[model samples]
Each structure stands twice: as structure tokens, then as C-alpha cells.
Target: MTGEPVLLTCDSGGVRTLVLNRPHRRNALDAELWEALRSALVDAGADRSVRALVLTGAGDAFCSGADLPKRPSTAHPLHRMRTLTEVTLLLHELPMPTVAKVTGVAVGAGWNLALGCDLVIAVPEARFSQIFARRGLSPDCGGTWILPRLVGLQQAKRLALLAETIDAGEALSRGLVTWVVAAADVDAFTDDVTARLAAGPPVALAQTKALLNENTDRTLREALAGEARAQAVNFATADAPEAYAAFAEKREARFTGRWAVPTRTEDDA
Candidate 1:
């Protein structure tokens, strides 16, 4: 579409949504769209008000991967790939939880994009593929790293090397998908889930997410120490005390993520 944003963004209930906007080409990642995505992700990561993030595609198909025919030839592949690497790392490192809502095909880099999220939800008819080998390329967008961690080494190899497309059920079986729901209910289900996440204790949830992501590479002792550090930080936040009070009162906790210890404010000065 002429003069349209390559990425569409919206905010609701502390949830930020970033949608790939190139539906006519199955939301392919041209250079423009990649930059758009990176910018949006950076903004989402920096915004403390955003407690959860959702990524999806417009019209149909989550994404078909790079727009090969339109890919820029001016720069070397390595240089061009830095953008993808940054985007992937940003998604992985964002403080809040992230979700991928896959409506249709998510292949190649597109598939890796979804895999980078904390959770993935897809419709029954959705499809996924590593799709790199068939295109005479290796996986990018953190695909190589995330695949084996998600599936086993063998399953990851099969998907990446064979480049075969899989239905949502098989993806679910292989643990690539968190849930597969009816297309009709996916929107409402996603909304409900993200709303719940947005309402969680922001500081604690962010620390928990970071711990889990880093634990795979950590020793038992290191992970325990990390957990201790996270808990110490959480204890300094108002939410932890609020939760304790709510439990004693037999009511729900309203977490504000404010600092529990006294701190100087501009008004105090």
C-alpha cells in the first residue's frame, strides 16, 4: 500500500501490539519492514507502561520471510543481517512478556521471529517452516539458536535442513506452538491472555522472564544465585508486600510495581 506504515501499532490495557503490514506479499520482510519492526520493538522495550507485547501480521499470514526479489544488493549479507540479529535479540530481551499470534503461514525468518517470543499462539490452519534449506540459505533471525532450544537437536535439524512446512498441530506437538485455537476464538483468547499478563506484577514478571531465558546457559548454582538476586529486587518493590497483604486479607493483589523503600522524589526536593 502506498504511504502506509510498514508496521501497524496499537496500545490497550498496557499491551502493545506490533503488526506486520505487508499482507499482499504475506507480510514479507523487506528492508523497510525490518527497520519498522526494530523501531517499534525498541519503543516497546523502553516504555515502562507497556507490560505485555503482541506481534502478528495484517490480513493473512504472519510472514513469508525476506522479500528476496526486493532485497537490497548494495550491502553485504553480513551487514544486512545485523538488523535481523538486533531485532531478534531485542525481542528476546524485552522486560515484558511477548506473544506471537500466528494466523497463517510463518516460514523462514518469519518462523524464527515467532519463536523469539515468550509464547506463541496459532490457529488450527496455520503453517510453519524453517524454509531456509529450500531457498539455498541457512536459518537467520536467531533461528539456529532458538530451534534446538525449543525442539531437540534432531527435530530442529529436520525442520531446518529439510525445509518442510508443518501444520499447526505438528508445530504444537513439537512444542513450537503454545496453543492452537479456533480462528474465531483466537482474538478473544489472545486479548484475555495478554490482559492478564499486563495486570501481573511488572517487576517480578520481568525478572522471572529474564531468569528463565538465561537459565539454559547457567549452572545450577548460578541459576539459584540469579533467582536470589531477582527475588531481592522483587522484595524491594511494593507489589511483593501488596501480595502478602492481599493473601492475608483473602483478596486479589493490585500490583503497581512501585518501589517499597523510601526514595527521593522531585516534589521532596
Candidate 2:
């Protein structure tokens, strides 16, 4: 996982695929890989050419965990924790929709990374685990915060406390993953979703994401007001006109907005 090349490439329909390239290490996140991934995510979010992102791994495993060899580093432990927190926050704050395509084992921080995405589509063969407990450590990479929100508090406790591996079927059933396709179909399914999102209204999607992330923490009055404000802004976009016109013309709407919007600052649960 050390000094591994980050696999980043954008295709037609504005789908940017960030593949974890360290197959030998099961795509573990070493310090270098973390920085590379942070930079790549930042660049993709800023690039208008990239409307959607599909985060996946290179070979058999989606990701194992943080690179164990890099632990207890030259820097202070608290510094490492702070750095990891910022990196995880960056992933969660990306403007465009991110979909994690999990095909194999996604353990510890790897699982958390996938959970950070707006949606996760995994293959039947994929497995997920929060193995930090097994290794005599606490969870990192937004796992502690995101897991409880995804699955209930009890489920989150089970995952973190037991540190046991669960398969894709269980993950989907527990509301952790959005969908579970066959192993051969995971890539194609993710591609289809990404393409669909890319062709849709980018501003609307971003607004929806923003609302979702803030909804649980906001009061009902505040949430409604926020939605109305967001809707007001979205209605003024070019895509909104095209959408109404397409409806009247009995055709599909072709949306094209690509700029990133400012993420709303809100307190987390």
C-alpha cells in the first residue's frame, strides 16, 4: 500500500472512477495513499468534467484497512488522528454524488470510506468489517460517526464491538449498502448509476445531498425553510427550464449544470 499509484480516470457522461490500486495489499490506506486519495477527491470535486464518482478497488478486495505498518509513526498519535479526521471529512463533503462499488473485502477504514459515500453498491461476494476492535484500537475514518447513523445505534455497537465480518447480503439487509448485485455485475451497475446521476440535474442532486446530510440535525421548521430556499434556487437554473420544457414537449430532460455548490455547514448527530 505504500507509495501506490492512485487510479483516477474520468470517462464519458462525467463518471470519475477512483480505483484503489494496491491489489497486493488489498488496497490498504497508507499515509501516501491517503494523501493521494485526498488530492484526487479534491480535484474531482473541483472538475466540472467529473459529475459523479465511483470509488472501487483494483483487484479482489475493495480495501483491507489502514496500512498497519504505518501506525505508531514518527508523528504524534493525536496528529495522525487529526489528519485522518480531515481526510474523512473531505470525502463526506464532496459536492457531487459518490458511489462506492464494493466487490470484495472492505475492512476497518476501508468499510468506513465506502460508508462515507452517498450510496454504496456492492457485489454479492463483498464483505464488510469494522476490525479495529479486533486489533485493539478504536474506529477511525468517520466510522464511529457514520456507522451509527446508517445502521441504528445498536447495530453500530455490534459492528464496532464485535469487529466481525459481514457479507454483502447482510450489509444490504441492515441498510448499510444500497444494492448488492452479482460480482460480475457490480462494475456495470455502478457505471449505470453514475451515468444516470451525471445526466440528471447536478444542482438538484447536490441540494438533495445537502438537505439529507443536515435534515436529522435540524428542526422541522429549519428543514422546511432550507428546502424551500434550495428549491427556489434550483428553479432558477437552466436545467429547471429545460426540465419543464421537456415535460411539455413529452421528452426526457437533459440537464447540464456542473459547477460545485457550497456545502451547508451544520452540526452532526
Candidate 2 residue-wise lDDT, 52-151, digit = tens = 8888898998899988884456978887677678778888888889999998899999999999999999988899999999999999998888888888
Residue 64 C-alpha lDDT in model 2: 96
Residue-level error in angstroms, candidate 2, position 171 = 0.3
Residue pairs in steric clash, candidate 1?
none
| C-alpha RMSD by candidate, in order | 2.3, 6.3
How many Å off is the CA of 22 in candidate 1? Answer: 0.4
Clashes of each: 0, 0
Question: Candidate 1: TM-score?
Answer: 0.96
- Please tell me which predicted candidate would have the highest TM-score against the true structure: 1
lDDT of each: 0.94, 0.86
Error of 2 at 51 (Å): 1.1
lDDT of 1 by residue, 175-223 (tens): 9999999999999999999999999999999999999999998999999
- RMSD to the native, candidate 2? 6.3
